[model samples]
Structure formats: structure tokens, C-alpha cells
Target chain A: MSTNGFGNISIMTRSMAWLIVCFLVLPITIVFAVSVTDKHYLSLPEQGISFQYYEKLFTSGPWMTSILQSFVIACASTVAAVLLGTLCAIGCWRLGNRASDFVRMLMLVPIMVPTIVYALGIYQFWIDLRLLDSYTGLIIAHIVTGLPYVVITVSTALAGFDPRLEQASLSLGASIGQTLRLVIIPNIKPGVISGAIFAFIHSWDELVLALFIAGRAVFTLPRRMWDGINESLDPTMAAVAAVLIAITVSLLCTDAYTRSRRA
Target chain B: MAGLEISNVTKKYANFRAVDDVSISIKRGEFLTLLGPSGSGKTTLLMMIAGFVQADRGDLTLNGQTITHLPPEARNLGMVFQGYALFPHLSVFDNVAFPLKVRKQSREEIATKVRAALDLVQLTALADRLPRQLSGGQQQRVALARALVFQPHLLLLDEPLSALDKKLRAELQDELKRLHRKVGLGFIYVTHDQEEALSMSDRIAVMRSGKIVEHGTPTDLYERPNTAFVADFIGKSNFVSGSVVEHRDGGFVFSGGGVRFVQRTKGPAPAIGAGVSIALRPEKIGVLRSGETAENELAGTLTEWNYLGSEFRLVVDAGPFGSFSVSVPTWQSDLAPEIGAAMKLGWSAAAGMVVAQD
Candidate 1:
């Protein structure tokens, strides 16, 4: 085939890819541009650059505390979800029975059911258990919501894994636990890490669950951002949003890097 | 050097018997192949020997010690799976060192053994490369080195060369045979390829439907299959169903479909009226000139001809006896047999053997 004969389809596909890329990136680019503006009341960049909004955000007390609380909650919840969800997915894969399939569907229910329903029900359950407004309660709620990400990613990784590796390891003087640690975990490390990262982001950015479950004592970043936006339109709020967007971009970039590495 | 003995081992998954009362013994340092087609229970039998699958009815012993209840790790057996199964994340050195590490060998001992194993497979230069970076043949050698590094009591190869191309498969077969001789460990190989079994094994257990129908040396199984299934499966054969005409010295004469055949067989050769089956291998039947004579001669016409590089396969239509194939060496043949040409086919009485049809 001649290069000229590659035809209009090749050019069309190239332009279409760029169009999709722009579609996904335009909002974030706009938010970045607005963040650096001197007047940041949700307007375009028509003024000089300034760092006063970022300074304002740093001086804010509740926002800083909420950021720390979000980090703590996300970290704790991701650890719990990845641990429990990976084990559950492994069990389901090995068993391949009706009961385990039902359990797998149950694990996926959080992803399917509306968050509002889960929040309302979980709020009532926590109140009955006297766990409402507690950090433990919030962590447990995030874990429940974040576990499906761990399950899906781990299951995707396990699809390429040969069950015979487990057999081969066991046959070669390794115990079941040793096989899980040495063979299974090493092979699925990328998937498990990606799942944990996604779960952490899910918990960190979650607003409705935090709103329904947490109180004044256990406010998170998203909850505080929701309150800040509702109360007043300030440049500090835009600065905080921009920082959250940066964290999300960093996490997504990390996920993409890990995915490419796995490939 | 542990010899394995399996006694009346039966594996029942629900109602279907995957390995039914199958018993075989592997002597120390012997290379035995479980040869069969797909779903013939060869792999299941190997898995049972490796302790991956438990036998429901019988016991297994290695070096006279009961290992039926032992886990695979405790059995101290090495295995090479169908698709190499080398860890993609690990380098070749680490993969071969894995078994030794699992055995809790010292770091220095592991290095020495891994190098020795890699050198044995001629893969020392590729030790630092990951498995995915190597070709199919190299990956297979890595798997072999990994399986052997720990010096296990027995080695199980489950169709180890099945994943490679034909040329590479043949190359690896020679390497595997050499490795077997060097290691001098008991090897239980499983493969569906009959030629692989014939070329590499000390003895072969021919399996069909979870049963060991025949077990013998490669020559014995090829030359003296006891059943029609075994005779047909091991090589190409022309089966002539007949009724016994007479019992003679160490043999019998049978007549089938208006054609007579003499068979060398054991026992009373069935009663005079009993039905029988005679199996004749294609290469055993010689193509002859017009005036040739033998203990059995048939008049036929060449119905089909195929040139197989070194040999000519001719399907001859013998009247009332159906089509019989004769394989003649191409080098020895003066002229190619033309299609529809009348030809004479002959075979000695010993070439055809009576086998049980079932």
C-alpha cells in the first residue's frame, strides 16, 4: 500500500481522536485558567495573575482540617476495602458456585444501588448502633462504597492469571499461603494498587455519603467544599476546588502510568 | 531418585469417573509417558501423581512411602505445565531460583543451583531476561530449568512441548530427552501426540476413556496392540473384520467379506465360527509387481495416491475387501503408482494381528 493511498479514513481517525481528547480535557483546562485569575468569581481569565486566592485558602481553618480528615478517611477506608474486597474476589473466583456468585452480586450492589438510598439506610443503621457522627462510622461507609472498585480491578487482573500457577507453586514445595504471597500477589500487584488508588479517590471526593453520615465533628473536604459553595461565592472556594482538581489529576495520571506499566 | 507406585486409583467427580481404577508404576529414573487423545485421562493421572488431585479409592507411594494424603508441596515433585507458566514479573534467574527459594535454600546455594540448571538447559546467557522477553522455545527451557532447579524426587511434564510450533517442538523434544538423561529423575510425561510418546518414552500407558487399555514399551504397543482402539489410535491401520475359518499353530485363518486373511494371535483363536478383527498397518503391506507372491496377496486398483515427502501413501481398492492403504518408500519406488491402475498388494502372515474390536 502506498502512503498516499492510506486515504481520508486515516486523517479522519486522527482528527476524531483529537476531538475526543479535547472533549475530556476542556473543562479541566478552563478550571485551571480560572484558578490563576485575579478575579475568580467563576469568570474567564480576563485579568492579571495573582496568588491571593491560594493564600486565602491556606488561611482558612475549616478547609485545612477537612482536607486532613479527608486524607485520613480515604486512606483508612481504602486499606479496609482493598483487603476485604481482594479476599472476597479470590474466594468467589475459586469457588465458582451458586452461593459465591450471589455473594459476588451482593458485593457489586453498592455500585448498582443509588448512593442516596444507601446513605439513608446506612445513616439509620448507624444511628441505631450509636455510630453516627463518628470517624469510624464514616470510614465504614466509605469502605462499603469503595469495595466494588477493588473487586472489579482485582477480578480483571485475575482473568489473565493462570490457575495453574497456583498449582505449579503448590507442587514446587510452596504452601497455599506462600503461593498467595509470592505468586498471586506479585502477579496482581498492579491491579491491586490501581484498585486501592481508585477506592481512595472515591472516598476522598465523595460528598453525599459524608453529608448524610458525618457531623460537625467529622467534616471532610467535599463536605466542607459543599458548605463553602452554599454559604458564599469566594475566590478561596475556587482555590480549594483547584487544589482538589490537582490531586484528582495526579491520581488519574498515576493510574494511567500503572496501567501502561502493566501493559 | 524416587519411584512412584499408584494402586487402583479412582477419581470420581460426582458420578463421572475421570480416572477409574488406573494403576501404573514408574521405576526410579525411568521416563514413562501417559499417551492418549484429549479427555483420555492422561493429564488427570499425572495430576494425581503430582498430588494436585486426590484419588478416591486407592493409595500412592513414592519410594515405598505413602504419599496419597500428602499435598503437592509435600510430595516433592516438579512440574512443567503446558504453557511454561513462568512468572512474567520475574527474570529467568529468579524463576529458576523460585523452587530453591521455596525449599529455603541459602542464597549462595540458590545462585549455584540456578546457574547449574540454566547451564543444563543452555539458557545461562538469558538468565537476566524476563519470560515475556524470550521466545516460545526459550520460555520452555526456562520452565524446564525452574522445574529441575530444586532437584525434586519426581518430575511431571503435562504436555510441556504442546504449545510450541512443530520445528521448535521437535528441537525441545531432543532437549527434554537429554535433560531427562542428565537429571536421571523419574519423569511422568503426559501428551496427546503418539509420535512424541513413541520417540521419547521408555514405556507408554495407552489410555482411553479413563482406562489404561494397554501398557508396554513403544515397540510393543506399536507392533502388538491388544485392542482395535489401541491399534487404530497409535498408528494408521486397515481393520478387516472377519470370522474364524480355522485354528492353526500359533495363529488362525479368518474369512471376511469374501476375502481370506491369516492372523498370528494367541489362545484358541476363537471358535471356528467366532467373529474376529485383524489389524494391518499401512507400512507393513508391501506394494508388489504382477508376478509377486506372499503368504497373503490381494488384487486391487490404486484409488488414491499421496506423496508424503519420503514415502508414497497409496489407497488400493481391493475387490470385496474394501480400500486398504500401502505405504512404499519413495526412494525405493521406481515409478509412482497412477490412480485407477491395477496393483498387487502383499503382506506376510505375521504383519496382520487379530485384535479385540472393543
Candidate 2:
């Protein structure tokens, strides 16, 4: 009845919060229900449930191949993006003035622009370089888009780091390389892991860039799902979405476990 | 043989000089402290010795070898930073063993040395605990163990105990003194705390504005400070500026505050009417009896008084000479001090030292 107490939830506010949670979670739950439906068509089950779509997804030729292809592409892009972005972040942190600010802003350009506009220009350049529909082409495109996540996460980690640790290591008869490996890296490992996880997720779920850059040979999971939805409405697409969600949840769990241990 | 000599060291920033042609040295087993206030070049000189900041101009030699340009790792100096700088991710044992591990020591050697070092700090019980798991004092011990485990040529400490509480700081100060005596290695310590500097160091170098203003044994500096800055910085002092009255006797006479002061000077005698400043320690000034007189005496009122547990600090307002503080022992006092009580203060000529104004 009154607003005097701090954080006291009114019935209206409590219901509104639950409403937003359901609004976000209901669609994913429906897809999960449809993935295990006994029916072949894309519909949530009323009574009976079976994992026929998942069984088909594991055994089918195109589905398994697309999953494997996406896995390799996502891992490769994440590795490249995390390594490059971490180095860039360190260099920027070391430079630490107006110039590094300009460089950091430039690195964020890939996230600022709409992907659709740049997708057209990139596809044209890829055709000239004969890299269209290739794993390298798709992975490179994914890395560019994922770099900002890695850089932001790693930079935040570095920001919290104490530079005096590096100095102490140096004073204790450790060289520059030893200081970085022993003192600096261990202190910032949480940031690096989260950055890698974010970059991997960014690449794994990316669609527009993959849709334009990839074709038959390098069909990522997202690309195949896009094509499947356009051509046919099977319950297997729901199975694919469930698998993607499972992987994302696992990555997030890994991040949370590491951060909690750090604390 | 492993003594260090700093010859005319200098460091400059963009436009300002941080250390200006300062030179000091210590023997192999001496505990030398560079004491100063903030921005007084004490830490800057320590960093140069540790090779974190190179001296723009000067030569630093250890034993007989020049180490002016050596990198920090190659300099073989141990430093205890103010915040301890213990590795948060490493256990206490691992943190202490880091220097040995980097030096390519065998497993048995590292384990034995780390155990001994941890035992020295009395933290062997917490060897397996991470640095973050320990209290502030425990972490400081781990840092000391880490710095000492390597047996570097000399140890450099930059206000290492400044972060701890007063009780913990006193505890660690005792621990550090014991370690110094047991290990017998040269120590170059930097601190703005004059009390710590006086209590810990075998020799103290007082710094001011990028220079070593004075260097001597603590007692020597306390008794015979060369300048007003050193006198005021080292401890509390009552400064009285006066013109020399007469050089009739070997002792000099100066008249100020309507009080004639017979002063002692170790240097050459000043001419008559020449200006001089005298530093009188608070405890040295005394409460004269009704008829008794000393070499120097003044009459004033006890305007205010603070009753410290062990001593009473009395502020006497002497007209024309301004106010000066006098500390009297509580147990030996015969008179209970009351506010606005008229009193006579007196001290021997030897109690006041002639100091330069600058």
C-alpha cells in the first residue's frame, strides 16, 4: 500500500516481473516440447512424447554434418578471436593513453554496424578472393564479429588487475616473460575464460554473417536451420534449437563455476 | 664486500627532477633507511636501486661491480611493496617458493628453503593457505618470506608495513628486526614514518625535496640536527630565532623572547649580532624552582595542556617569542598543571642545538 519500505514488491509489480520472465522463456519451452513430440509435424505434444526428432538428428546425414561443421568453425573462430583480442587489449592497456582509446574504439566497429549491410560487401570481397562457402571464410567472418566481446571482457579483467604484481614478480628474479606467465596470466585467467566463452557463443549463434558468407560446403548450424525453416517445417528444427540452447547453458555454467571459484 | 654505493644519482620526469644528485651507501650487513615525507625522493631512490626506475644520471655499484643499468631481475634485489604484493592465486608455500622455482632450484631444495623461510616468519602452519585466505599480518609475513627466500644481495622495502593497523605494524616491525639480525643482509628501507625509521634502521638518511639532507646514526641526528628542516622533520622541536649577544665565554649567548639563551654550537663561533636558529627538544626544557636558574630560561603562562598517558604536553605562550611546547614526565612532576597557570621554563645550554634556518 505504501512505498516507504525499500524493495517491497507490490502484487502488480510481482506479477509483471513473472510475466516478463514467462514472455522470454515460454517460446524456448514450446520449442523444447515440440522437439520430443511423437508427431512428425512441428507441433507441441498434447499427451504423448518421444525423442524421435533427436534420434533423427543424430543419425541423419545433413544434420550431423552441419552440427560438426558448426562446432569446428565456432571453436576455430573463438580461439582466433580470443587470442587476438587479448593481445590487443594488453597492448592497449600498456599504451594506456589517447592513442589506445582510438584503437579500442576502432576494434568495436564490427559490433556497432548492422551485420546485414556489411554482409553484402563482405560476400562480394569473398567471391573475389575465392573464399566464399569455405570454412576459413566463415570462421574469419565470425572471428571479426566475436572480437569485440573478447576484447571487452579481457579489458575489464585487466582493469581490475594490479600492475604491482608484475613489478613484484620482476623484483623476485623473474624476467618479463616469466612475470606475464606466472603472475599476470594467473591473475587474469577468469577474464580470459569468460572472453573465450563469449566469443564462442557469439560465433555459434551468428546467422546473418554466416548466411551470406557460407553456402553448401561450410553450412553452419544456424545456416542449415535457416534453410530448413524456409524449405520445410519439421519438428527436427526444434531439436536443433534445443541442442544449441544446451551448449549455451553449459558454457554459461562453466563461466559461473570459474568466477565463483575465483571469488 | 657486498656493500652498495650510490654516487650522484639523479632522476627527472617530464620537466621536474624527482631525485637530484643524491648519494648514500650502506655496508653489507647494515640496515639503512631512507626516511622522508611524500614526494621527498625516498621511494624514488629505492626504486632506482631495485631497477624499477633507472637513475637518469649516476652510478650504482654493489661490492665492486657497476649495476646501474641492470634490469630488475638481473639486479638480484628483494623488494617488499607497501601492499605486500602477494600473489592471490598462489598458496603461501607457493608464493614463498616462487623465487627459488624461477632460479631452477631442485624440488627438495625449493621445499627445504620455502619451509625454512616460512618458519622464519612463523607462518609455516599456514603454508597451504592461499594469500587471500590470510589476515593482513599473515599476508605480510608471506611477502617477507617470499622476499627473503631468494637471499638476494640486498633487500629494498617501500613502506611495507604502512597498510597494517597500529598494533600489527608494531608486531611486524619486531619480526622484521629479528629477521634482519638473523639473516645479516643489507636492507634499504623507505618510509615516511619517522618513528619507524628511528626504531628500525641502524643508520637513517633524511631526505627533503629530492636530496639527502642528512645521514647519520639515529641518536646522532636526533641530538645534532644540521638544519631546521631536519630537526622539525625528525621530531618535535621548539625553534627560536635570535641574534648572537656575546662570545665572551667558549659558549655563545643569544637573547630572544626576553630570555638570554646560552647555546652550544659544534661548528665555528658566530660573530656578535649574527642571526642563528636554535632547536630545543620538548622534554629537555624543565620546570625551574622558584629561585633556581639555568643557562637559558623563560617566563610564560601554561595556556593549554594535554594529558597524554605517559607524559603531559604543556603549551607555554611566551610574549614576543610566540608559543612553544614542553613535555613533562607525569611521574616525576611535583606540580599538577592547571590552565592559565603562570610558570617558568628552563633548560641547559647543551639542550639546544644551533641549526641552519634552511
TM-score of chain B of 1: 0.95
lDDT of candidate 2 vs native? 0.90
TM-score (chain B) of candidate 2: 0.97
Residue A82 CA displacement from its true place in model 2, Å: 1.9
- Model 1 C-alpha lDDT per residue in residues B1-358, reported as the tens digit of each score: 2588899999988888889999889998899999999988898899898888888989899998999999898988889998978888889999999888887899999999999999999999999999989999999899888988888888899999988899998988998899899999988999999999999999999998899999999999899888998898888888888798988899888888787878776556688989998889999999887677888878889999999989999999988878998899899888567998988888888898678988
Candidate 2 lDDT at A20 equals 100
Top candidate, metric lDDT:
2
lDDT of 2 by residue, B179-265 (tens): 999999999999999999999999999998899999999998898999998898898899988889888555799887566788876
Identify the candidate with maximal DockQ: 2
